[model samples]
Target: MRRITVPIALLALLGSAVPAAAAQAAPPPSIAWTACDPAEEVPEGVLCATLEVPVDWSRPGGPTIELALAKRPATDPSRRIGSLLINPGGPGGSGVDFAYFSGSAFSPAVTDRFDIVGFDPRGQARSHVVNCDSDLIGAQYTQLYPDNRAEYADLRATNRALALSCRELSGPLVTYVDTASVARDMDAIRAGLGEKRISYYGVSYGTMIGQQYAELFPSRIRALALDSNMDHAQNIAGYQKWESLAMEGSFRQFTSWCDRTEACALHERGALAYFDELYARAEAGELNPDGQPLPPEDLVNIVFGYMYNPNSWFELADTLLYLGQGDGGQTGRGEPVPNGYLPVMCSDFHFDVGAYPVLRAIEQAQNRLAPHTRLNPLAWSDLASCQNWPWKVTNPPHRLRASAELPPILLANSRWDVATPYEWGTSLASQLPSARFLTYDGVGHGTYWRSDCARAAIDTYLVELRTPAKGTHCPAVFPSSPVSAQAVPTVVDPLPQLTGPFRR
Candidate 1:
């Protein structure tokens, strides 16, 4: 699951278009956005504002970047607590927008009690997007069972294509995508709002932002809930290693779900057989209803895309049902699938256009880490993009550990999340002596959105400032149904010709 930091997405555009001086100067008494007609699509209570912060804090007198801010006044102004920040996960994702869109995403209590705030960290959507040249999507390496040198060569060409694409479109911000800048922006936002302290909820990459924010401004934090925690404490290599294993485990659970579900397509005991066959079909240029060739990884991406939300689980099952049935027909999958997932999946994490070779080497390194495990397409894409990206190593070996003095944080994780494994949750949470780790025996990525237990625990923390006992690690509590119980079952001809079931 390639989650973006929703610091932008959830907030949308809420705050006012004030002069940049406010960010450089002291904050206003309370947050407010310019009055405009709120559209049906926009959140009702959202207010838009801008925070003028130094583009480079080191050069305070230098040029400034507009830090987007969105605020939703406390549901009950009489009981308004304070500005509560929300981030939706992608470092590249939107957070400022979450303030506008997170109405229902947050638990009822959190929304009712605190004034929600979100912002796009610099270099993300609506906050100052960074780009490079070339169509990284078309140039990406597409090896099905990337087994031999021949496949690697083909992958190389595609990787090169990706590099050229990202490089051409990118400018100065490419080198400034580091999280420190984002943390600084958060501080500026707090200043702009005249808040002594900040409250935050971050997921996926958002957790990394939260950790950095908390670490940098320990005294500035009122409360924080970081879900699907990012391991800034670990090296990028280690991060990818753990994520690979996580993907393997999650895919296994996915297969198991297929076996148990009446709606899933691969019902046999060894669903791997069916998967192999399906990939082979795609390699031979299978077409879906959209008349586009369905690459194997494309198939994987569609399935991987929705693993973040239980709301999307049935959609995945439905897709699988079609894939299983479509593979049987001559036109491949008869109907189109994944129109929405493809664009973002293809273009979102694109690498720089010139660093094609770098992308290839990065992928090579990542794939070598777990030669036998299932790898997330997005996971590999990150490494590839980083390799080709113009960004430099400011905190490349980002090993910022949580401080012992911070208040107890509640860390949540899904055992079957391909993006963040349970190990990461416990591992990082362990570093923060004040933190209490919670696990859910669920599939897909992230907390909340679908899991009630996670939402309840997080909401309680956000609203009540209560948490699981210190060092009180909760066992993995999954939905009552087995992982695969909700998946549908179908009979697809297994590939008997396939060798020892492919490891990945």
Candidate 2:
């Protein structure tokens, strides 16, 4: 879990600032592309550019902020259909880095037909960034379980202080980094590319951006494919509960695999019991002091992080074995890799945690129902810190409806996605008047990177404008045996393909 800030009185200024410049006829925004700097990671023919967008859409001409953009042009420009704008869904994930890293992964057909483009959302890396106290963040880390009322109170206070620190450091842009704003930014990118209608590929929180863009400018979308969908319809408590349940399910799957597979080092010792012992030891703070000892929360985080993709299961198993043997010093399991989770998430949903007692009740209930996911407390409590957040939430949770004239948007989700639950994909599909849902009967979060079925569907939909039939299901594919030529190995598979190349 990552830490975030919740500024106080943030909403009071909404619409209170100088009213947005009145609607007026104006020239479309244009991007001036330039050759990217020499770098090993950047592919040939990829161009980078920076465009300015208003901090407030209402005032499109005022207080401009620079947006970083990058593009990998179609291999066959003559055959190009249009620009394919992508958002990798950190709300903080860098679209620019994603395009450079994963450009080659797309099938040749896609590369030939589309100019792949990516941009860093406002207040994200490579764009205008949100700064805070790195030391404070490093020290506090994420608090997975609040053992008592005082601990919960301390957590809240720490959150409040952090929010203030971030606001002071991040400035006004932090208050404006909502999905609605990013959706508008997408439209600008579409215009800058000189495309009448842009195709889209959004995953995770990126799905929310796609949904909002559909609602706001449905006519501008040529084709949309949202993977690992996010249902922005739920409020704070509901959102927390949904995530908790999903993580609990993934936890069970992980332990079950460990129990049945001889490949798992702890199998003979009873994987479930081993896990229980690890948790108990963590809680007791009895692990060795070889380096930086991991608390119970971080041990859970390490396990939970690897649960996103089973390809990493072997590595996860190895990591657990080392920790269990008291061999830990500094572990990557709990290291903080910030992707601007705070500004966007806090601006989108308000977590309504009242007094300390209220938080206590919520934590107790979640623990009772999902003990394995005591991790939810930290993930959820971070939201409540927004109560006094200085910036107002510009876009609260709401049902999104795509225009009837829009093409049927494609949705892909795995059956056991802990980060963005499969249920969310299904729920989002139902809400959209025009949608085609493809279910991957596999583990992990995003599907296109790992499942052949998913890739085929996405390719057909994006390139041919053909939607898969409703209720389409893709079967799970396990790692192949050593002697079996039929198996596709993804042991080091990254959870979401686009961000994989950049992962530390």
Clash number by candidate, in order: 70, 14
TM-score per candidate, chains pooled: 0.74, 0.87
Per-model C-alpha lDDT, please? 0.59, 0.71
What RMSD value applies to candidate 2?
Answer: 6.6
Supply candidate 2's per-residue lDDT for 154. Answer: 62
What would the TM-score be for candidate 1 when compared with the true structure? 0.74
C-alpha lDDT of candidate 2 relative to the true structure:
0.71
lDDT of 1 at 252: 65
Off by over 4 Å in 1: 1-32, 36-40, 134-137, 140-171, 263-272, 280-293, 324-373, 470-504
Segments in model 2 whose C-alpha atoms lie over 4 Å from true places: 1-27, 142-144, 289-293, 327-339, 381-387, 480-504
TM match of model 2 to true structure: 0.87
By TM-score, who's the top model here?
2
Model 1 lDDT tens row, 318-356: 666577566331321122111111112223233332334
